[model samples]
Target chain A: METSSPRPRAERARQVADVLRQRITAGAFDDGPLPDEHTLGTQLGATRNAVREALGLLRAEGLVERRQGVGTLVVHPKYGHGLDRLVGLAEALDGYGDVVNEVRSVGIVTPPPATAERLGLVPGAPAVHLERLRRLGGVPLSLDTTYLTADIGVPLLDHDLAGRDLFALIEETSGRRLGRADVVVHAVTAGPDTAALLDVAPGTAVFALDRLTHLDDGRPVDAETLHIRADRLTLRATLHRGPA
Target chain B: METSSPRPRAERARQVADVLRQRITAGAFDDGPLPDEHTLGTQLGATRNAVREALGLLRAEGLVERRQGVGTLVVHPKYGHGLDRLVGLAEALDGYGDVVNEVRSVGIVTPPPATAERLGLVPGAPAVHLERLRRLGGVPLSLDTTYLTADIGVPLLDHDLAGRDLFALIEETSGRRLGRADVVVHAVTAGPDTAALLDVAPGTAVFALDRLTHLDDGRPVDAETLHIRADRLTLRATLHRGPA
Candidate 1:
């Protein structure tokens, strides 16, 4: 949304910024730091001022960060999501590398009245509560909390989650695979606990994904709340006019 | 994300809050105020304090607002976008009633270098730019900025918007139907201008949707930026195994 009339000299900086934007979006620095401004200037044959301006624009866009001694680090190259995928968050970021599931806790807890209602159980009934931090390359991506009814909850927590997917593990333990989920998406600000785990300031905007996963027999198997850091990830959804 | 052991007395308030959340998410009060504390208590058969706490939770969740003299007002009842609808911002909120498109400005100007590039035009080439504030029931919902290439831009601006969809008008004026768009979604903070128009505090989190719409012949025809108030909008996207 530039308002001033454009000048030819500014083209150099614009071009530099455009190429950098492409690299950031392509996940080129998924695990590494971006090139230093001096290096970019030399390689692109642009002035140091041009490279500086380009990097400044990127920082404003929240794509990269400059630490005191860390130099210029690509803080978050967008997590590009296609609009048709229905996979789990772990599966969605598999291509980005180092999708680590850090299980904070696994135990039976009295379900929240809302969670019980969602799972069609008595209020305050016991349920399997799994709290996890999904990290990519050691940087936390999301806080995932999954609640399962007693039948599935009891067996699922008995086994430690190996390298297998969470959904796959639930299937193995409960002897039933979840078929589908009714999902609700919310744009919310992170609270104290969630903000701490995601390494964002409290009240930072986040994406809250609430899902009720059901079994093949149509019994509600699990209710999950995925709180995703908005700066680190982006999601797409398709809108169809009428039913196909 | 509650930690304390559940108390029996809290159950009543929790139930009250749960029902309120459902109504907010369903856009049940798009243009009205939520019932007052005493009224809610009478309706839900809960104590007044319980109603107060329930409303407090909804406020923290950014659903309802407690105006001093206006009582509790529903602020950001999530705008559930199903994803496939290609309708304009006005049409998208038609269900909410009285979607007003207030054009802030419309004129020809030198496009931002990046926007010009996307439109396949030389730097500083003239393009029609339109800035608008979308209001639902006199409440501002989003700030929309649309840029049209000269071929379509010149003719489109000659007439009033006249309750027409921007894309539909582009096709009417240029005789070319637009096709797909490459959309980039960003969870960003609103700047002073946008924050003021949406009547929200400055730096409030918002959703930045930048889209480059193309013609059936694969020619990029328009570039638009829509800044939606997070308090008012919720977007959903899907994920799949591999590239579709």
Candidate 2:
């Protein structure tokens, strides 16, 4: 491939990474001890400085590891966690006792433009918006909002929603089973509303989770938006490599 | 199931969602036309107000859509896009078209605590930290830092790197093939250095991509931390709902 100009340091790092990559891929070295700087410098006919720099580049690319006394070793690929678990949120929050629920506001109104578009409803369709400040052990963790078409459970307006299992309520009232969900995740800073709700300074980092849920029959049932503190939540996935 | 409380509004919305979800999952509703608000309200024995609120909930979940004249309909789930592509940096740069490179600092030094831990090297291991400003075209995009262990590619220090392909050079010089990578993505705000490089005001939102690369024989080779403009870049993944 023809080369384009890159920063001198990047070029150097790339060069070193390539050399190490080839050796590892070609099975030239087992997953064991890597040559020390002195040996590698002499073997590659390069100075120790150059070899060390190259090693840094490889480390940045996750290619080589330098153990304290064991030397550098080759590692394996990591697979992504499958999303079919259908049981992560509860598990993640498990053992964290007493999540505080601050009911920011609950009201019936029309869906916002974005919500309307997703629901395929006419603009200004009547809807209910419930905003909550969720805390773990009294420390705010997330600011979330739920929008629901009003007719499903008209009986809900009068209840104290400050504490309750939303899903359980629906099953009991309508005899409907909750099934699958589709989720979209992204990073965002706390907007004005979330900032106020979570009691964080505006512009704090947050993980946004947008979810669309369905029933056993494939009907869409619920949609929710969650803005969670990045420092508190850990998102992990297991992945598999393909095509070598 | 016995009624826990009389939250009429919440209940109505939940009931409607239950039916809609059940019907959709059962294939009774073919991801198509949802009953109009008036009809759904009557069937659920609730007012249009209640039904509308329920629909709002569904919309938030990304399940239903309401068209101007078309009424409401069920929505299909968005699929996952794998992270296994190993997209080239050049390709990623071209996709944005404004990637600019600013060499924050290019010099040899000892590895940091975090880098050393990940690379399994001792802290202060002789390494080079090359911090750069990565932009798309002329627009500021990300702040990146790459650390290369010394003795790996000191030859890089002698070359001019204003526009080069680091990976290509590495492969050519070392004869190594690039392999799989593991990435950890999270949301964060630009720290002082990143703020300057990205030309964004301090404390602006940014997405952090922490990546580690390995060889076929599973040797850790390199690690890099990328700070990207949150609004501009989107990391998407496709989730496969395993078979029922």
Off by over 4 Å in 1: A1-62, A67-73, A122-126, A159-164, A170-180, A215-220, A237-244, B1-23, B27-61, B67-73, B120-126, B174-177, B216-218, B237-244
**DockQ for every prediction shown:** 0.23, 0.09
| Model 2, CA-based lDDT | 0.55
- Interface root-mean-square deviation (Å) of every model: 7.0, 11.2
Q: Residues A1-244, candidate 1: write the lDDT tens digits.
A: 3234234344345345545654566576778777788887765556789888777755655667898877888877778654564566666677778677777667787765556777898765788877777878788888777878988878766565534457767777766656656666666655555667789876666776666778766778688777788778876543332311
Give TM-score, chain B, model 2.
Answer: 0.59
Indicate the TM-score of model 1. 0.74
Q: How accurate is candidate 1 locally (lDDT)?
A: 0.68
Q: In model 2, where do residues sit more than 4 Å from their true spots?
A: A1-88, A98-100, A103-109, A122-128, A148-192, A208-221, A237-241, B1-100, B106-108, B122-125, B148-182, B239-244
Candidate 2 lDDT over B22-122, as tens digits, reads 34433455656877888777555567887787777555433467878888776542222234355435444553343346666677665544455555667
**TM-score between model 2 and native:** 0.54
